[model samples]
Target: MLARNLPASQTTEKVVENCPIVMGFDLKYARAGFTVMQSVLETTPDAQFCAFNVLHDGLPDFAQRLGHLLFDGPRSSITFIDVRPHFDHLELFETRHLSRAMYYRLLIPILFRNAQAVIYLDSDMVCRRNIFAMVDALPPGACLGAVRDNISRGDRARGAMMRDVMDHGPEDMLELSLADYKRDVVGLDNPDRYFNSGMVFFRPSEITDSDVQACFDLCHAPRYCPDQDILNTIFGDRTHLLPERWNYVLTFPETVGLIPDDWMRHHREEEEHAAILHWPGPRKPWRDPSVPQAEVFLEMGRRLDERLQEVAPEFFKDVLPAS
Candidate 1:
């Protein structure tokens, strides 16, 4: 039986009093972070929320305003960590849409030393269920728990793309051939079962400064997805594969056709019960209102707006229309 289908009575009822959820964001992704945090707070209601801002230029002001809008009566508190100093030595990879802050996710263990375990989420994702349920399901001895990157599993071309990035040295990324990537990068016998780094239940004790440093070092290499590549390289086999419902990645019909049959069947079944809805790729629900899952995000945004209007109408007055 899938974890998502487990009745509420059977689900673990442990109240996660201090479960810390760390999210990375910048000015560009501030709104997405708010939606993510809002969704989590709505679902968990009692967990601690922390935001790590990679851009320090106006973080203090943003954090103050965000706190006033989100944290009303102390049901949950948001902690803001300025990660500018950490980014000084690290490389920031930026494409047209993706930001450098995505790489900062790997630094969660180092940033929050006191936390035994931390939940790291990309700002583009929204929690649809109580995340503590996933946290409680972490298997023993596993350093990290995450869902398989079904986008890669469903399509051979996508798998090859991942291999191209992983196998080639930073300087040789463009020279990739499918045969060489299969034979040299990821072994032929090993199917590409890379997990998405967007939503992770991580045990901080399993990570070390050296591990963090190694990932950062890999960032300088010629890689397509920096943090994701490092995570797949380091914790690929060590990670415990969680159910797809825990991190249901949104996809369109065209992409869905590319996914393998078995994975597709599983995706269809688990999607309805998804605990977190992850908007990967360029089409974010917040940005493009036409997206299939746009309503989910928009509804959450509306709910947040109403809450803000009730609690702090002055702050709500400055709210910009969702892009």
Candidate 2:
């Protein structure tokens, strides 16, 4: 951990009845947030959804209209936090699938000092769980609760190299192995302990400026999965590792046979029971038709377009399901 100053920008708050849930995204992915949030709302309507402008990307034009039509658009709803000043200076780390927005949730503790507990969800997630109840189930004094990622729980051999663009092609892809990098940088002693940053609940109690500084220090350089690595390094032993169902990674061809065949039957059942389905890495279901649950996610976008077309036809001029 190191010492650093938190940004002085004030957060915009809109009061909600239940749990305060935070999501980070820019204008490009704002539509994805709408589809994902609407899907979650279908299951759990009381959950408060906040759009975090991590890069100070101005509010999406459709937000005000959607405020009145759908979601908690009425008064005392949908808190919007402007975190532009905080991240504007940094050279953001991103891959083909990830964006600078991936780094936004790291500063949640510093930005949201008032909330009792904050839930951070990536825009790419689609879920059917009562997330608020999940927050309630966290053990006392639990700072955070998250699922073990595909790497942490599924396989350790896959950790040998990161499947990411690192200014290196296939010729030198294994130059810096992920497991070796983690062991050296964060002193990662236990291979099974690394947790993903995508879906997490933070019950912040005494998070100090120093802890926030540690987040800043970690991102000073880019790794394979920049934010995921930083969060694992900083949270260390504090993360309450939930079951694999909390954030199950949708299987693609490359990931299908990796899990042993004996457990494939169990894995299929696990998929049906997954609380939140995550489309991690470069290939996203919304964009790539080959993904396992691509239709399930695209259907969400189609449904979102249909409703908006009925009420706000202008919003769907470009069409929601269109790539």
Candidate 3:
């Protein structure tokens, strides 16, 4: 159990004693998920024991095996929650990068009601630093915290689409013209601050039922990144943009030269001191280890494979097919 009385009104430099981290994944990424958990345990060895709330589709055998492996160590406690029931409402939406959008709005709040704050990390990422530091540094009154998106830099079309839906209504989003999304949706007055939803530090207590419903309603609208877009639309103003080091997005070597020098410098710094490595685009490390810096992810996967072979050979069947 976690402390639930943390104040949600203003910035308070205080850190919670016990922070709970949550992650959502499907069977397709179970191995990656295990690697992520293992990395966190390995990196934050000194932090007091933490709890990991893993939300996944119900698979008895896989869940049992994962439980045994994760619980074998005393550094963390694991709780598995089956999210199959939430699939019904998501059937109409196209699940491009996300397995289920409801996991962000509905599932997290419910599962972490007792927690004052929960760090929600995508299973595809690996932890490189003590995540509790971010949890401790969370700004008060903010519903969500995340790193600024590096890929969304010049793409102003997304902002335009969001503006269309907000101004004319959800039905008009697709019909809107794409002049400049960043200037339109993100607002010219405010700094162009779009965040990547891959790694989020959420204050579940601050999110209300109405906010969840608003997120669900936004999901019905036509958007490129549904859950991410909805979250930005709803909490964009209240979001606390953390330093990029916390959620460093990886880039490929071939395309690296195409980006601006400043961007390259930022990425290099992030790579050097990355607390979490996020494989954002379609080219993931598992699919193509030839990508620069992919060795890190591949190493984690290799370690997970070895552990699976040793403790639970049956679960090894879930490993990705040889490329």
Best by lDDT: 1
Write down the RMSD of candidate 1 (Cα, Å): 4.4
- Listed in order, each prediction's TM-score against the native is 0.83, 0.79, 0.79
Candidate 3: Cα lDDT at 240: 91
The most accurate candidate by TM-score is 1
Considering TM-score, where higher is better, how would the candidates rank from best to worst? 1, 2, 3
Instruction: Give the distance in Å from residue 117's predicted Cα in candidate 2 to where it truly belongs.
Output: 1.4
Candidate 1 vs. true structure, TM-score: 0.83
The ten-residue window of minimal lDDT in model 2 covers: 1-10
Model 2 quality (TM-score): 0.79
What are the clashing pairs of model 2?
67-73
Worst 10-residue lDDT window, candidate 3: 1-10
lDDT of 3 by residue, 1-323 (tens): 11112112222324346468777765566667777877776666443566877777664565546656754566678877777676555633454444463344346766676787888888668776677778756778898898877666533423334453333345445454432443354332343467878888888878887887777665555555566766777788878988887888775344344445687677776666677888866677888786556777777667667767777676564543323
Indicate the residue-level lDDT of 147 in model 1.
88
- Per-residue accuracy of model 1 over 210-268 as CA lDDT, tens digit each: 87777777766555556776787777777888989888887555655677777778888
Ranking by lDDT: 1, 3, 2
